[model samples]
Target chain A: MTDMYDFFNFILQIRNFVIHLQCSITLIHNNNMIEIKNLSFGYLKGHWVFNDLNLTVEQGGIYGLLGPNGQGKSTLLYLISGLLRPNEGEVTMNGTSTGLRLPSILSKIFIVPEEFTLPAITMKEYCQLNAPFYPKFSFDELSENLKAFGLDTDINMASFSMGQKKKAFLSFALACNTEILLLDEPTNGLDVTGKADFRRFIASHMNDNRTIIISTHQIHDVEKLLDHIIILGKNGLPVIDSPVSLIANKLCFEMIANGATPSQNEIFSKPTFGGNNIVSIRTDESPETEINLEMLYELAAEKPSEIKQILLNN
Target chain B: MRNNITQDKFLWSRLWMHIKREILSNMKQIRWQLALIVGVVLISEILICSNAYDNWKQNDYFYNSAFQDPAQLPILLAMVALGLFIVAIAASMTFSSLRTKAGKINQLMSVGTSAEKFWTRVLIYGVAPALFFLTSVCIIDLIRCVLVDSIMPIKAQFVIINPFIDETRVKAILLFCSFTACVSSFFTTVSVYSPKHAFLKGVCIIIALQTLGSWFLFRYGNILRPWEYHLDLAYWTALGVLTAIAVVLSVVSYIKYKETEL
Candidate 1:
């Protein structure tokens, strides 16, 4: 009986070792992406902005981080970029803790904060001073981006207006060619034409190795450019975090023409100019439509668990 | 350039580039500071020269008596004090780039290790100011002395002030240099600990530390009498304590710099 007990114990130890090995391998596989695990943070003590939050961002997609005010959308980006630290757990990029601020990690990441102060120097000098740090910085690309934004490289940044400054900075940031780019309120100061240019710049620069996460309240400005959407709910919990393609497959967004009856599968609706916009469960007969960001946000805000269940069921 | 991986390991090339970036980025502010230093020193020295000439013209023997020593001790002391003042200001502004939220993000996100950034500030803000102060003040004094001698009718024996004129003066110079270094490092650490209004905070902390130290010494004077019996031991002990303090402050500054968050 003693021999039998020892044999079982040895087998259990082997099983545990195998499980641990598999976990290690999974971590190695996840090294190429950004991972946030069990992260809790707050500006003040005992007033938690996020509690036990977990997220994973992969490469090759433009992700929109959306939520209401004070939901920690901007704070989350800062945490990922190493501008802030978590009270618990970790945020890692390429298998390294971002909070460490290692040069290896810093060189690969760039963040365009909502409000920034550009030095009182000409754009040419600015590039000369800052571009050497990122080995992949491209002057040609910078010129092209600046041209797209209708800016000149010789202009003095000190004299530019806030909108112009944002454009110049956005041009430079995209030209840096970093692996991960975090943009907060990128279109806040841009004009209508500039906003369209901004979208074009983003769409043209994206590549398979790059991951851009944009946090903005201007959902209409980014809806067309996004391939993934992660919406945060109250207390900084994710209401829905999924690819746009998956969201489109499980749900249908449409404009119900005037005098038409509401569909039986409707989940949420909002009144509009000519008709009512609706988000509903996708059915066999439902024609595919582009995702309506405003309607989708309302649904996620009003019926978070219902949407989560629908996304999970399929 | 193509996408490449960077390492946290110390590299001479990277440090050199980081230092260059710091200088170029702050070139405008540095130029203004340089102008201010030169302007203040020039105006003060000229005033002193003019006042001496007026005194000599009115009372020949009286002015000669006062100006006998070409290397005036008080003037040398004044120059050292000015240098320390410059060092204090420069050191206090070492982390000025971290003052604003945007500036803090730009600096912290720059591609360099924390050690590289810390040492760069120490060299630019702490060491460079002291060197510039020494060189510029000495040259200015030389010019002032020569110009005054040529313009005055009487040979007043006006010459450049030298800190190494005698043994006592040399020792005094050494003491002042050590004090200046300690002050510079203290302000450097203060900049890291308090980036906003760092100069004001540093001054307050210095005044507080001096008062506390004096009080501690007075309170424990009787208990420390044994050290007085062995002067050599006391001297070495004091030196060791100072060296340890400097090292600890530097290490603490580096650690604090590394852990800074927005």
Candidate 2:
């Protein structure tokens, strides 16, 4: 009887320790807006875009969804919006399943796709019709952004140029004041000035209630803005990764001029027009080493395995 | 706790914007069609009312001409078309709504425009056109009444069908709009299934069902003369079965659209 009592007390002590451990973990994670588990999807009779793809995004940071022309970056966003159904897997936002494009889920999330064709109606009318859906959407913010972007509310949507269209879409997206924002190729049509403004808008509006995911092949535009990077590649390399770790440790790409041959450990290289070849190597370096996103993409595309090994090493 | 409809409450608002824009732009695109349809329908209504008046004269013109009641056979038959026109306009709008705002909708969905919002947009896209169509039909109806001094035949006969026909005129308008809503909802699912074009699907459904129905009758009844056959029970039963089949197909199409990824 005494031994039985001791065993019960031991079990109780272990349970208390586990509970404390769980509390600490919760404190460590304060702002997680989206969490996807085993998300695998494909159209009927087609190959899967992502199989067992697991990802989690917390709030108040810029996440770059980088991939080639098509590796399902856009598809993933569609899944989150419940615009597309997954053959298998589940998407949860703040502990709720995204099924049938639930209104609560929609009010908190906004998307801006690449191609756009606006209606013949004025922008103001458009806003009036769509504003009620987003509880946090602010007209003042929309007006301010429109002014900053040099967009006139009086102009019909059909009148804007492609760059102007993108600007309008971006401005409209920001006004939604959603907790989750999805932007696909937001900077593709913008001029340099517009791109700069886009970066500024992102920096200014970020808060606990919002998380922005930008999918693009223009790594150069996002290099400075991106805090976390998920690279989608199937060239026998790592499928996803963060920019900070990629630049700070595990991978290095440097230009080696003629007369200075790189060691065999060099992950990849090819002779260039000026006789200086760019080579990638697996190494741990301080993040002070600025990342050349364009060069990185090219080198990684050339040698996906080298990048994969670097990821595995980490 | 939460029903599916409430999730994308914002979508209805957004769709309202999209619908307005589509209606404005498409109205201009179909301006010629609108003018023609209105002209033709007005002329038709006058001709039909005049023919009814002529028929009354031939029959000694004693009954009071029904003007207030919309449920009379003559008006209902003329307006049996009202709902189809409304639904056709709604379907056309839906076919173009997503394509017009493709970038915005795609991006919005990624950002968390809920599926409910998408469905709401579909509803608005379908209904906005219907409301506009109803307005146009109403104007034509008013003109017909104004030009013809005698009672519009519809105003004469509807209280005979049901005495509660006092509200029949207004109810007809509402019913026309509602019938279009249901048709467009099904059309939306059809649109999603065949994004490039739905004309063929619509044609196929109409033709195939009709052909199959006649074939079923021949195979089941096998009667060449009506007087020799007493198959009213069988005929009604067949029609009921066919209608159930159509309903089931519509429901299935809706489910397919609900789960479609794009």
Candidate 3:
């Protein structure tokens, strides 16, 4: 009987070990990946854009990088994508320094700048030239994306208007199927329908292996799609870097009725034609609400310490 | 397949693809430049040959004296100089993609080793332009031979100026080639380094450095004096030094290109 009990115990231990191994593998596959450590960068001497900035971007989320004008939102995107080298530290993707711009790292990352120039080639020719660099590029996806944007593969990009060109480029960027996608002001020149298509296309294409960072001042266009928010403070420092779920849990965003008095718990507020849009700390009884990105940005920009303290306490 | 794409090391296939892409993307501009070359060469040759014909009709002795040796012809030397200037200008435009933020981002983010990209530009701007110029001139020279032999009042063996056939022509071509290589390499490096107006900056830098080098040589070295130096020895020495500097500058250009940032 004791021997039997020992055998049963051994079997249980094996089962536990197998489970642990599986968990470890899953964790390794899906974890915080891109790490920016002690990164100091500046365009000029003694005026740092990002001084000793440290950031870690987890895989598989749509990150909205937000900041006011001239605060280095685009600069940060460039730094992360390895287009800009830091002065003091490094930005690494999967433990490899991005500044090296190794093909391994670059192939997995694609950046769509706010402004760009397409060669005078047709979309097909452009893809023929560029698609080989990205191993995971899918022609079918390119076709689908282009169709969604109301563009054709045979159209000459040089003849495209700015909006149409943006759509085409964005479509190509998505079809590259890179792990990390960086977009700066993606929706700026996009038409109303194009913006809707952009959101839909991005949503449809997102997967567990991909992480998209969209840096844009046009909050409404991307607010619904963001899984995380990163707001840069003065000197390109991030004041709020948190998941949308956590943000919703800690703060409530809502519009007060026209006659309602100002709430004491309000962290930030702005008057609207119909009512006042306010961001306030969430109480235990309060239900989670949709994030008001504009209001939230104002709160973080105005009362950074207060917002930080509130989020930290939760 | 993903592993192949992610390989950071230099691969020949990828480099070849990059070269193809670079050429195809700039195909239109290249076509325009080639047309311009043909136009310029044709017009210049016609003008020179027409003037020579008129001179020949006026006086055969003066014409023969003026065009006694094709190798010593000022027109050939001037054509070579002009070709070299064009090469330098093309070299200065090597990093034109970096002029705009968007272009810079696109280029820097493109998936290829820096060596691959740098070598592509070197081949396209540095080496290929010089070769193309040489070929274009040779072809035009052939056309000129036919035109001159057929139309000249006194045809004095109007053969093509084949550098391979004559030692003097070969030496002159080599000297000009080396000088052009040096100029192009320097201009290419400046293109990688300068923020704006790279061509102007490169020209200014060359002028300043040449002046400084001449001043130092004149002030310090008596043996380097124009009258004292042996022409052949000085010529060979200058050619060797220029070639060495060109090689060094080419390497430096690659290094600068690899480390360039937006």
Candidate 4:
């Protein structure tokens, strides 16, 4: 009996060793494109913008970075792009720290800032000069983007209005074909038609190898395009999940009449023009409805722990 | 060894690409403004030279003595001033993009190593502009000589030969070049640190340096005279110190730029 007990203990040890080995291998080949560990950043000392924040963005798909006005949505993007360094902790891309900014790493990322000034040159000239840095840049795709945006390649960028310039820049950025694209408030200066064009342009350009993270307070602009959503709060990230998982596992977004009583499961409700938009827990096996991003963002910000617990429990 | 070589080749290629992009972007943004400024300077210099040539022609005694072995004082002074002015402009605008928040983001986020970006800016705004200024001075002087020769019977030519050939003038030219380089490097360093009003701060520092140097010279004029101490040694010492400062400033600037956050 003693020998049998020893044998079973040995088998248990072997099982533990195999599990550890598998975990090591997964870490070595970490598929997540970006990982932020214990990130603490602030513009001024003693006034923390992000406090001990941690986030992991997987490879591929468009991610909507939503937050309140001063919750560091833009700052987070800047840190990931290596434009702003975190006070503590680090931002890594595929297990490499972005702060190092190696040529190999830099070539794989592009950033489109909210307010950027283009050189006073034609779009063709700009591309000719700047495109060579990005190894995967495609002139054919640039041409297609220009055509789609109704912009002539030969037109001087200095003459372009703000909206036109943004369109042209967005087109160029998409054509650069970097693995990671970080856009901060990209649709701010865009018109209604320009925003639609922007959406189409982004959707057409996305590939399995590419990941685009757009940080914006305007959730409606990017709601339909997002595969994953990250809603930041005053302290840390409260929500980091795909739309499908969000709709299926945690919350049910519904539009009810103005005078109708909300169900007991309804966690949050907001008044809309025609009725009240309500977010409740998913109970039955019915097909998930489309998520209301605005409502989701509000619930996440105001009652993060409640929403977090529901998500975790589900 | 083979992998290392391939990596080096890739790095060099990327550096070259960045340099080309910087040059093209600068040309697009500032070409017309640069042209206008250069045109104005050239015209003004031509006018001044023509007037001096007329004076030399009118005064036979002054013309005969100066022309016998032209002093080249005015030409030398013009060249020195032109070199300083060109370097000042280049240094002032080298890292101007850092002044604006948007420009800083655009610049720092671009694809390239920090070292590569530093060298690109130095090549575009420091070395290239200085060389262009030197070439312009030589060409303008040649043109002035030709104009004088065409107009006057008495020939007074501003020789276009290399300054290194003249043992007497070599030290002066070298000193001038070194001073210009030092100033340029210093201002470039200032641009990296001072985000706003960089040009103004740089000019103020230069003025302060000049005042201090003048005071030092005045205070020790008798003790440090050419008769007591070897003038060549002093000149060489000053050049060495200035060159050291310039190199140190450039290295510091590059390191600061690498760590700069927008």
Candidate 2 docks at the CAPRI level of: incorrect
All candidates' lDDT scores?
Answer: 0.84, 0.64, 0.84, 0.78
For lDDT, candidate 1 versus 2, the one ahead is 1
- Assess chain B of each prediction and give its TM-score: 0.83, 0.56, 0.85, 0.84
**Of 1 and 2, which scores higher on DockQ?**
1
Per-model TM-score on C-alpha atoms: 0.90, 0.72, 0.89, 0.88
Residue B176 CA error for candidate 3 (Å)? 2.9
Give me the candidate number with maximum TM-score: 1
What value of lDDT does candidate 1 attain over all alpha carbons?
Answer: 0.84
Q: What lDDT tens digits, residue by residue, belong to model 3 across residues A1-314?
A: 99997888788568546644654664577586688899899999899999999998988989999999998999999899998889999887766678889887799999999889899999999999999999999999999999988888887788999999999999999999999999999999988999999999999999999999999999999999999999999878888989999999999999998999976778788889889999989988888899999999999989999988887785
Interface RMSD list for the candidates: 6.3, 8.6, 7.2, 8.4
Query: Number of clashing pairs, model 1?
Result: 0
Please state what fraction of the native interface contacts candidate 4 reproduces: 0.47
Candidate 2 per-residue lDDT over residues A222-257, each given as its tens digit:
778877777777621235465565554655556666
**In candidate 4 chain B, where is summed lDDT lowest over 10 consecutive residues?**
B1-10
lDDT of 3 by residue, B1-262 (tens): 4457656567777888888998999899978876776677667766766665565556656545644623225457557666877788778878878888877887888888999888887788667776777677777767666665565533443333667987888998798778888988888988888746878999898799889989988888675587454788878898999999999998998888898888
Isolated chain A TM-score, each model:
0.90, 0.79, 0.90, 0.88
Scored against the true structure, residue A144 in model 4 reaches a CA lDDT of 93
Residue ranges of candidate 1 with Cα displaced over 4 Å = A1-32, B1-5, B52-59, B62-67, B153-170, B217-238
lDDT of 2 by residue, B1-262 (tens): 1132233333344444444544454455556655655665566666666676677667654456444433235755665565575465446445443443473354334322334335544555555445555566567666555544354434343211342557654554444434444456556666656654564576566688779988988897555456346565545454455455546645665565455555
